[model samples]
Target: MRASVKRRTKTQQDVQPETADVAEDVSDRIRATLAKAISEGALKPGSKILEDAIADHFGVSRTVVRGALGILEHDHLLERKRNRGSFVAAPSIEQAKELFEARRTMERLILELALGRASDADCDRLNAIIDREDAIHHGTDEKAKAELSGEFHIELARISGNGVLTELLEKVVARLALVMTLYEHEHHDDCGTDHHRAILDAVREKDLKRALHLMDEHLADVEGRVRLTQDHGDRHTFEAMLASFSPQ
Candidate 1:
């Protein structure tokens, strides 16, 4: 009987790590799912986030869902309104402008840093990201194109070798994704690729001034594509808003 009890104890010990891992997996999945919702426009600006619905959809408890929502709220993707529950964040035209301006500044700094510090392998990685962006541009997937464009910028930030700056850039990029969904006027081809290539070339040549200028021009082009206005007519309904929260 004692041997059987010992065997049971061993089994419980072996299962503890797996249980902890499963808990972590759930938390990560929640974050990723909500992030995708925000990115894809399923969670539109000002749409209510039903905790119970998310819990049911993901087959997790509300506690886990709340934790996930809390993280997104911290990230500025979700906002809690007094007595109105959590809703997807809505950026006004002025807000969007401010966000883009901040993005421009951060990205230019990241480019300057990257030019100074990027290793050969980092450059290669950036090139690979560019290739992926190009492929997405040529492909028929519009959503993929938008996502890849954002990722290209994030990859550049990563190559800059500044963790704090990278984190800031990631937040800016997430906000940009929302802006692109709401305000993009045209599906311009090449997506500032020549500018990226120019920046990369300048970096490879170790020309910091030229790289910074190229980055400025690229950001200007991006900002020029947005047509922000007060008219959010079609995106104002609950169902319409909820649809926006999900992936496109």
Candidate 2:
């Protein structure tokens, strides 16, 4: 009887850490899914996140959902109220202006540095991303295309060979996605591939001045299209929005 009890106790103890790991895995998966949804515009700014419904959808406890949302809140992707739960962050027009200004500064530096160091291989990699963008347009994945749009900028930062700049640009780019969510109009979600190709070609030809000018023009074009003084709302529940992303 004593031996049997000891074996059962050990089994329960072994299961405890495994259970905690599973909970953490659930939290991470939820965080990534929510982040991607926000970036892709499926989860628009100011949308309320129903914790209970999300918990139910993922078959996890409310505690797990809270953990995931807490991570997003830390990233500024979500905001929590004292009694009202979490909602997607909605930046004001002032905040949007600030983000774009900062992006312009960072991207100029990024492009300048990348131009100085770009090898033939780097140009090839950038062209591949553009090719992928073209393919995404012909396919049926708007979200992928939007994500690639953001990635193109980040990739430029990466090729600049500045890790600190890359890190800063990543945060700025993420916040800019939220700005786009609040202000972008129909058919204005991308920084046209042609603009990207033009910049890449200038870099390949070692035309520093022209590349810098094109970068400025491209960012100006993007900022010009956003409606800074407009109302923003979307009529989709959190679960319903996420459900659309799920496979049949």
Candidate 3:
């Protein structure tokens, strides 16, 4: 009987690792689903995430759901509030300014690095992305345009052959998505593709000066579209009537 009891104990211990692995896989799937939703703008900024509902819908434990939400929070895709559940992060105007400033600096550096390292084939890859960016007309969802526009910058970072810069740009671009959603003027037109084409043309010609100049103007145009003026509010008013426009 003592031998049988010993065997039972060992069996239970052996099962633990498998159970843990299953839980981890479930957690990763949950994290990926939530991340994609946030990326695609299905979950808009300032929108609350219902943890219990997610657990129930996925047939998983709340612990697993929390684990997934924790990862998203780390990515700045979701913000967890004390005594409140997780919500999609909404960047304030101040945060928006900082993100754009950082992106402008990062992008210029990324361009310089990419120009030095990129092959003729790499330049062609960029042209292909621009081709895709121009494939759809204005009738499509604006989010699609933004997604492709973002891919352009991310591809550029990847071409720089620097993993650190790639990671940083990815995070900054993720946050910038939230910023654009919250603060862009209704009539603001995105002009990313044209600028990208010109920059790529300069790159292929090895004209770094022209490429850099075009990049600066492109960054300015992007930042100029966001309404960054101070407004009266408890946190953010979001009153369209009271919204101020940036200089044209």
| Highest lDDT model number | 2
Summed backbone clashes in each candidate are 8, 0, 0
lDDT order of candidates, top first: 2, 3, 1
Better of 1 and 2 by TM-score: 1
Clashes of 1: 8
lDDT of 1 at 106: 88
Q: Which stretches of candidate 1 lie over 4 Å from their true place?
A: 1-21, 232-248
Q: What would the C-alpha RMSD of candidate 1 be, to one decimal place?
A: 3.9
Q: lDDT of each structure?
A: 0.78, 0.83, 0.80
TM-score of 3: 0.83
Which of the two, 2 or 3, has more TM-score? 3
The whole-model C-alpha lDDT of candidate 1 against the native structure comes to 0.78
